[model samples]
Target: MMAIRDATAMRAAVADSWHRSAAAGVLAEDSCAPVTVTGDQLRDLRDAHPLARVFPLLDDVLGQAARDCDAIMAVSDEVGQLLWLCGAPSAMRRAERIGFVEGSNWDERLAGTNAPGLALRLGRPTSIVAAEHFRHSVKQWSCAATPIHDPIDSRLLGVLDVTGGDAIVVPQTMGMVRAAARLAESELARELLVPSRPDPGTGRGRIAVECLGRHELLLSVDDGWGQRGQVRLSPRHSEIFLLLASAPRGLSGDELAVLLYEEDGGSSTLRAELKRLRDLLGEDLLVSRPYRITADVTGDWLAVEAQLAAGDVAGAVRAYRGPMLPRSTAPGVTRLREGLADQLRSAVLHSAQPDLLSTWTRSVWGADDYDMWVRLRDLLPTGSPLLALAEGQIGRLDREIGL
Candidate 1:
C-alpha cells in the first residue's frame, strides 16, 4: 500500500480533489470501483455516447502509442464511466486489477481521485502521480487525461486517458493525450460536415450564450457543420450578446445604447463595439439594421426561465447557477439579472421545497437574502436536524440586521 501524504503537501488540484473525495465518503485505504453498467446496458450506453462517433479516431491516435509505452488507454463518458479500454494484454490486465475496466465508474466521488475523473471535473488536461491518488490501491499507477468536448455544442463529451507508471505522467504524454482529444474533436467536426447527415436539433444551428454569474460571457456557436466552438467575449460584447439574445426580434442602435451605457453613449462608440463584435462573430451571425444573432440562440438565464415556465421548480432551482452577470452594472443586464433572481426566488419560496430553498439560500446571491433564510427555516419540519441549522442561520442574520 502507498503511504498517504498530508493534504497540505499535495498539489492544489490534487488536494482539493482529495478533500472532495473524502467528503464523498471515499476511503483513503481502498475501495472497489462499482461496475455500474455491463453487457447490453454497457453496449447501449457506448452507442449513445457522443464520443462513440469518433471512437475510431481515438483508437487510431492513442492505441499504438499506448501499446508501445506498455500503457493502457481508457475512454470515459462525461460521467466517468469507462466506455472502452485498449492496449497490450499485459497492460490491460494490470489496469483491470485497479478497477479500470470498461463499464466501471471512475468518478472521483465513486472511485476516489484519478486523472480521468479530475480532468472531467476541471475540464482540462490533468496528471495524477503515484500517492497523489486518493485510494491506496490506485497509488501505484500514474496517468494523464484530458476532457473532450462535443464539436457541435461545446458540451463535455468525455475524457481520454493514458494510465501506466511514471512514464505516463511525463509532459510528453500529457501533450499527446491533449492532442488526441483535439484530434477526436476534429474528426467529430468533419463528420458533422457531411451534407447528408441528419440534423439532430435546432436545424438553424444552436448558439449557447453563457453569462449567468460570470463577468465575461462564453459564446458557443455551431459552425453550420453542426459542430460547435467557444469564444470568450469582452465584458461589453458579453452584455451585447445577452441583450441581443434576450430580444430575438433585435434591438435598434438607440435602444441598445440606452441599455448599454449609463448616459450619452455616442453612436460611433456603440458602432465600434458592434463592429468589433461583428469581427469576432463574423458578418452573417450578427446582422446589421437591428442587431441580432441569426441563429437559434439560448442563454443560461433563459434556460432557468424555460424550466420555471414548464413548472419544474426543482429543475429551475438546479439550473439557476447564480445571479446573471453579477459584476455587470449595465442597465439591461442589471434588470435581466434582478428579474431572473426574483423569479427563481419567488418560485422556490412558493414551492417551499426544503431542498430547493436550502440550495438557494446557500448560493452567494441568496446567502444574504433574509426572506429566503426565513422561508428555509419555516419550511423545514420541526425536529428535523436541518431545522436547527436553518434557525441558526436566521439568528445570525437577525444579529447582522439588528432585528
Candidate 2:
C-alpha cells in the first residue's frame, strides 16, 4: 500500500502518472473539470455503449459489496467517462461535491492523477491515496482501480474503481477490486455473445428548456441512429413554452393569455404567438385546445425543484443556474422567478453544506446577500481562507445599510 502522506516514496508507475497529469496542466487545487456531457447527450451515450449491457451485473456485484463498506464502486469507459456509480449514500454525497457522478469525465486531463484514469492509462491495477491525488479537492479520498479488457480481442474496455477513505489503499481492498474487475470482464464477454434487446426509450425526442438566466430550448431527437441537433426558441416562444411546461395538466388559451399579457385583451396576440411557436416546434409538440407541452420537456427550474423535493439541497443548489428568465416581466414568469429564487435562498441559508455556502458566496447573486454571508461567516472555521471574503461582504453590507 502507498503512503498517503509522502509522495517521494510512491511507486514508479504512480510517480509517472503525476508527471503526466502535470504535463496536462491539471491544477492541483482546482475542482475537477466541468462535465463533458449532460442531459440528453449523456442518455444517448449510455444507451449506445456496449457497457450498458453489463450494468445490471455490475450493480448486483458492486451495490451489494458497497453496502457493507464506506466506499463506492465506479465504472468508466476507456476514455475515463463515468458510466455508473454505486455506494453508501453518505459516501456518494461526498463524492458528488468534487464532481464524481455518472457522465462526468475523469480522464487524467480532466480530473488529474486518480486511480481510474491512471489504471486505464497504464493498463493495470493502480492505487491513489490521499495527497497523492493531483487535485486538492480530492485529497481526502483514496481509491484503487483496475482496467477491464475485452475478453475476445483483449481490447481495452473500461476501468472499475473502488473509492473511499484510507481503507481504499489497503492490500485487501486492492485485491477485491481486481477480482471484481475480472468478474466484470467475464460477464461482459458472455453478454456480447447474446443479441441485445432494443431500448424502448430510444428514438424518442428529449426536449429540455432552460428558463433560468436566458430562455432557451433544446430538442434532441434520437432517430434510432443517435442524438441530433437542438432547436432554438424566440423569447416569446420561450415564455409560452415555460408556461405550458409548468402546467403539465394543460392550461386554457384564456388562462395563458391572462398569464402572458395579464389581461383577457391579448387573446388574439396569444393565439398568433402560439401559431408561430407551433410552426417552429412541430405541432405535435404543442397540443392545442388546451395549451400544454405534449412531448416530455424538462426545464432547468424543474431540475432544481426535483432536487429540492428529493431533499438534496446541495444538488438543488448545483442545478439552479440563476433566476428564472432574468429579463422576463410577464406576470407568470415573474412569479416563478421570485418563488424559485426565494425557495432556493431559504433552503441554502437554512441547511446548506459549508462547501455549498462557499460556492454561493462567490456568485453574483450571493455576493450581495448580506444575510447569507452572515450565516456563512458564522459557520466557517476561524482562520479559514474564506473567512476574509465573508467578512468583506459583511462589511460592505454594513456600510450599505448604515449599520
Candidate 3:
C-alpha cells in the first residue's frame, strides 16, 4: 500500500530543510541531549549524596522495553539515532543484521534515504522498504515507524521502529511499532499524567498493570481460580507481550509474526497456536484479524499466539511461567530461549546511537553494572587525559555541592 520512489529529490529536500533549521537555531540542541544521567551520576548519588536521590524511572522503563522488543524492533528519539535494538549481537557487529551498521543516522548520508527519517518527518507511523528509501546504502533495509504520543493529551512523544533485511516487510511490524509506543506512552503518562488502573474481569480473572518500582511495568495476573503465579514467558514472548499489553489499538497476524517470529513455524502454524492460547484462556483475548490483539480477546490458542507474536511480550512472558517446554526441554525451547535472551539484551545494553562507544561501554559495564555508572566510567580511561579531566570535574562537582 506504500510507494517507494524519488529518494534523490526527497533526500535533497530533507537536507536543505535540515540545514536551514540548524542555521536558524530553530531545532533545539537539547532535544538530542540524553533525557538521562550517566551511570556515574547514579553512582555519585549512591556514594556521595546517598540521599542526593535522583530517580531513573524513565531509563529503567526504556531498558526493560528494549529487552522485551529485541527481536524485531528498536527505539529512538525524534531523530533516527538508535537507542535500543534486539536480535543482533551488537550494533558494531550489525552491518549484516540491521542492514546498516551502528551510528548511521536516519537523517545522515550514511542512511542516505530511509523510512526512519520519513517517519520522523510525518510524525506518525510510516514504512520504507528496499529501493523506496532515499539512500541506496540502506535500500536492502525495511523499516516501520510509529510516533509515540503524550498520554492523556496524545501529543507527539517520540518514535519507535522496526528494521532489518527485505524480510523486514511484515504486517506485525506495525504492531511492534504501536505496541512499543504504547509502553512508552504509558511511562510518559505515569510520570507526567495519571496512574494506570487495574482492569480485571470475572471469567478472564484479574489483570494488574502497575509501574514496576517507578519505571518499568509489572503485569501480574490472578485468575481467581488456580494458584496465582506470575507469567514467565521467554524473551521473544516478553517483547511480544510488552507490545500487545499496551494496545489501545490491536495488531494483525502477519504483524505479530514479524515481532515474535511466529513461534517456530510459518504464519499458518502461528494462527493455530493463537487459537490454542485463546481456548486455554477463555474469553480473555481480542484479535485485530489481519493486524493486532489484546488480553481481553477470547483466548483460543490462535488468538493467544497472535497477541503474543504481535508484541505482547508481557503476556507471553507471564504465560510462559513454566518451562518453555513444560514436559521436556526440546531443542525448540533451547533455540527459543537463546533468541529471547538475545532480544532482551539488545534492547537494554545498546545506546540510543548504538555507536562504537556504546558497544564498548556496554561490554565493559554489562557484565556487572548496578545501573548508570558504566556510562560514567566510559568518559575516562585508566590514567588517560579524559580520565584526569573527568576526575577534575567530579572534584569540582563535589566541592560545589559540598560533598
For 1-403, candidate 2 gives per-residue lDDT tens digits of 1223445787777777776665444557666544555687568667766677777777787756765688899988766778788998999999998889987768775577899988877889988988778788899999988988867446576898888887556799888887877887888767645543434545344576755655454443222324344566776777788888889898998788777765555677788899998877666567787877777777778989888888888778766767776777778888888999888888888884665675566455776788888888899778554455467668767988999
Candidate 3 lDDT = 0.42
User: Which runs of model 1 end up more than 4 angstroms from their true locations?
Assistant: 1-20, 23-25, 34-52, 63-72, 77-110, 120-125, 129-131, 149-158, 164-176, 185-234, 249-255, 262-268, 271-328, 334-403
lDDT of 1 at 186: 91
Across 1-403, the per-residue lDDT of candidate 1 in tens digits comes to 2334587788999999987676555666654575656797689678867788888778888978998889999999876889999997898987787878998878786678999999988989999999888888888899999999867557677899999987676789988999999999998889766555445655466678877767788787874645566788888898988889888999999999999888889999999999999898777688878888888887778889999999988777656656777888889989999998888889988996776776566455776778887887788676543454466567777888898
Highest lDDT: which candidate? 1
How much is the lDDT of residue 191 in candidate 3? 55
**Model 2: CA > 4 A from native:** 1-205, 221-228, 262-265
Write out the backbone clash pairs for model 1.
151-228, 152-228
Q: Per-residue CA lDDT of candidate 3, range 1-403, in tens?
A: 1123333455554444334323322222111211222344324323332111111332343334334444245544433444444444442244443344223344422233345555666676777766555434445557777776545434343456666664557787666566656766666556533333544434445444432111222344555444243343433343444445544476566566655553454877766666654544343443445333433422222233454457654333223221222222333334444454344334333433223222222232232332222344454346331232233334444566687
Candidate ordering by TM-score (highest first) = 1, 2, 3
- Taken over the whole model, the C-alpha lDDT of each candidate is 0.80, 0.74, 0.42
Per-residue error for 109 in candidate 1, Å, reads: 5.3
Comparing 1 with 2 on lDDT, the higher-scoring candidate is: 1
Model 3: ten consecutive residues of lowest lDDT: 26-35
